[model samples]
Target: MKKLALNYVDTFKGLSKEVWWLALITLINRAGTMVIPFLSIYLNKNLGFTKEQVGTVMVCFGLGSLVGSWLGGILTDKIGYYKVMVGSLVLTGILFFGLQFLETYTQFCLGIFIVMTVGDIFRPAVFTALNAYSKEENKTRSLTLIRLAINLGFSVGPAVGGTIIVAFSYTGLFWVDAITCIVAGILLLKVLHPKKAKVLDTHENKKGKSVLTDIPYLMFFGCMVMFSFIFVQLMSTLPLFYEEYYHLPENVIGFILMTNGALIFIFEMPLVKYFENKKIQHLNSVIIGVLLTALGFAVLLYTASMYASILIGMVLLTFGEMVGFPFSNAFAVKRAKRGNFGAYMGLYSMAFSIAHIGGHKFGLESIKAYGFLQTWQFMAIIGAITVVFLFFLKRIIQKEK
Candidate 1:
């Protein structure tokens, strides 16, 4: 047992120093993001906003993220990943600190939008840097580790954030989140110094050929937008479902979400590695994931009891999430041109932002019009159709290949 443990330690030691720093940065940044899971709660409870108004405000945050993703790619191409990430983190931290003073609904919405936009700008730069740094053989594992760190933060951050909110106020939560972002920014700037490469100078090269010209990449992003539209329901609609139907307490909801995060942290890496070598057609993984996620929603719709059924549904959702996310990233990376990796990643992140806005706007209104179960049933149908569309799309891309 001791020898086995030693071997594991040695294996970790063999990884690139950059991977370790990336994972640490991911964890810290994600810890700061804990505020998101409870943002709806804070707005409704503390700020006295209606559900529709909250949804509108959240869309502003999504809009900021959409713009940030594009700007991050451009900046990364010009100044390199490390500088973009450092700048993003520092600005985000300042914005987050400023959030404590926001009392009015408009102020809250605007503050969150600015903070999310500046903070999320680091995503594409960071992902591109990790992809560039990792060996082909270790790329999946490295990405998985980064994701695990994110989930680890997800697990801890919500539970802690929820506890703080319960004990103190939303202001305290904002302060903690802001401090963590600043600390993470400092650590990243000190540890990871990504040198600018001439290869990534998009301006000096072809002025006509932009990153958006890549069709397969655009299709992939389109698929992700659809996927996020379905997935974001978990955040926007599911809590309302639990509250209305089961009368589940907020703390219980937090625990359930923490369970999802814990499961992802435990299983995401191993599953990614296991599927790494399979030539299973990237779209197939996506299709399967979508189908599973749809099934999770169906289960939730039928769930009469609270704990056990919800847990089962969550497991399925997490499993689907694990399969879907990394493959989407890998597919994007595979299709991206060498110098424009950050741009591709940025485009990819924009899909999620778009989906978040679409989901919140659509999901809430749909539930109001159709009723929760019927609305979810419609979502499941949409998810299945999306998978079918992607399957055909994959065939076309494969034929081109």
Candidate 2:
């Protein structure tokens, strides 16, 4: 037990102080992430919108995210991540506050679209900042550390958000989210300002291959889109499934989802460290992650014990996320070594944005048309197809090497 504790502590060694600061800011920002997880439920139960209407609103959110990510990449390269992160976070906070005022279906659809457009701009800029802040050898661990903060915050957020919803109202979530964003931006501005911290500029001036024209990357991008499409159902439709299908309460559902974040917080870093030390291929780890994610959903198909299945299924998905996301991020950073991280990570984020548009719509529509069982099956099949694509991507990477 002592050895195990020491091993976990060792993962924190060799990281730059700046990376730790970055992770701290991420923890604060993500800790207030109370809105998105419960957005669909709020629309359905409180606002009395149909699932179809909620789907439309979410698609709009994805459209805005797509625009935000593309614009963020360009701006981060042209200006710098410092300005982009500050502006995006502060503006997004204000927008979150404004969103509570929107009522009608059309109003919500348009409002959420604009808010997400501004909000998601933070995604690419933050990624670029990660590249600047960490050393080359420590990049994957740095990314994992950031993810650890995010999951830790997530573990806290939904559980707290559930209590807020119960004690106050949905409006309370916006206030907390808004305040956190503003605070995070201000803290970032004070601590990570370019004047104080050393941000690398070599990648900024270097011309790299256009992501649009990169063939292998384009293939990987498609696989990510599919992967995200399957993964996002956890946010969009899964809550609805818990509510309508299983008849679980909001707090119980929140705790169930919280289990994913908590488990990742406890296990992901050690797992990534193990994989890294073993020198496993990034593609191989990602393939395993994808397969496990498929299995996570498949577990739900067993209807014997509701409590047991939900816990087990969430455990599978959390492990899959733990393995998949960090390596995939490192892979993108490695490819961008020749060029600009802003552009590469921007396009990488855009894949999730695209999935956002399609995934929410697909999941909601599938649930509406067929049923939850069929939807889970479709998600599993998509994950399997994505694993095949990743194998081809592996070959392409090897050939390039």
Candidate 3:
């Protein structure tokens, strides 16, 4: 038992101070995302916006995310991850704090856009830095640890936000999130001060290849978009489904999401390690994950009375997410050009932005037409379709390898 414990400690010892600091900052940064899980609720209940209006307003957030991903890539390459992350976090924190004072719908929409743009700018840069800092052999574990931190933060954020909403107001959640972001930004500024490496510029010149022309990287990016398109439904439509169809309370819905994050925190690392050495293809992992997620959605369609059944479905979906998420980052890092990590991570972030936008638009329309259960069924079918696309993506990635 002691040997086992010592070995575990040694495994963590391989991580550098920079990685640890970055992970801590990421946890603090993401802990402030309390408002996101309840944004639709806030719009409907607190701000008196219709569901349709909320969906339309969300489009601005997606647009900002898309722009931020592209800009982060270019700027990270030029200025370094440290500066980009710090600046983005500080700017975004200010916007989030300002959201508490907004009254008009237009102002709320603009605030969301500004917050998303600045928040997303640090995302790709931070992930790129993590990849750069990790040893090749420990890279997957490092990424897994980061995911675990994110899930841990998310678990706390929503539960706390739910309580705060009940106790005070949605504005309280916004203020908390803003303060967390500011603290995270300050910590990151102190810890990450490395000079910009010129290796990517040299590689681009030597290979005479445009950064955007990497075919495998593009395929991976496309895969991220497809998966995120299916997954974003959980946040956008799933809560509404619970409220309208299941007749569940807001706090109950919040608890369910907390469960999802908690499961990821507990199981993601072990699952990633299990698949790390296996010859199972990256595309295969994606297919399996998406299929499980889709099946979970399908199962939810059959359960009308039992909340336990809904919890079972959540288990399946969370397991699927665990399998899919870490591997996607690993695959992207593997396929990325040496020293151009930021650009590749940015492309991945862009895929997620596109997916969220598409999912929100489709989910809102589908829920209106078919109702919640049938809409989830439709999403399940879309997830299965993504699995089919992965077969083609696998061949492309293998050829590049």
TM-score of 1: 0.87
Model 1 weakest 10-residue run by lDDT: 196-205
Angstrom error at residue 88, model 2: 0.7
- The lDDT per prediction is 0.78, 0.87, 0.78
Tell me the tens digit of each residue's lDDT in model 1 across 1-401: 89855644443443467887889988988987778889888888888899888887888888889989988887877887888888898888778878878889888878888887898789898877777667656665666778788878876788799888888778788788888888898988777755422122222224424667767667777888888898988876888887887898888887887777777765676566567657665577778788888888878776667676788888888898988887777777666653376787789889988998788778888889988889888888878877887887888788887
Error of 3 at 306 (Å): 4.0
**What's the distance in Å from true for residue 126, model 2?**
0.5
Q: Report the lDDT tens digits of candidate 3 across residue range 118-212.
A: 78988788877776677676677787788877877877787788998888788788888888888888877666666422122222323324447
Top lDDT hit:
2
- The C-alpha local distance difference test score for the whole of candidate 1 amounts to 0.78
Worst 10 residues of 3 by lDDT: 196-205
- Counted clashes in each candidate structure: 0, 0, 0
lDDT of 2 at 89: 86
Model 1 clash pairs are: none
Stretches of candidate 2 above 4 Å error? 38-52, 162-173, 200-205, 239-255, 302-311
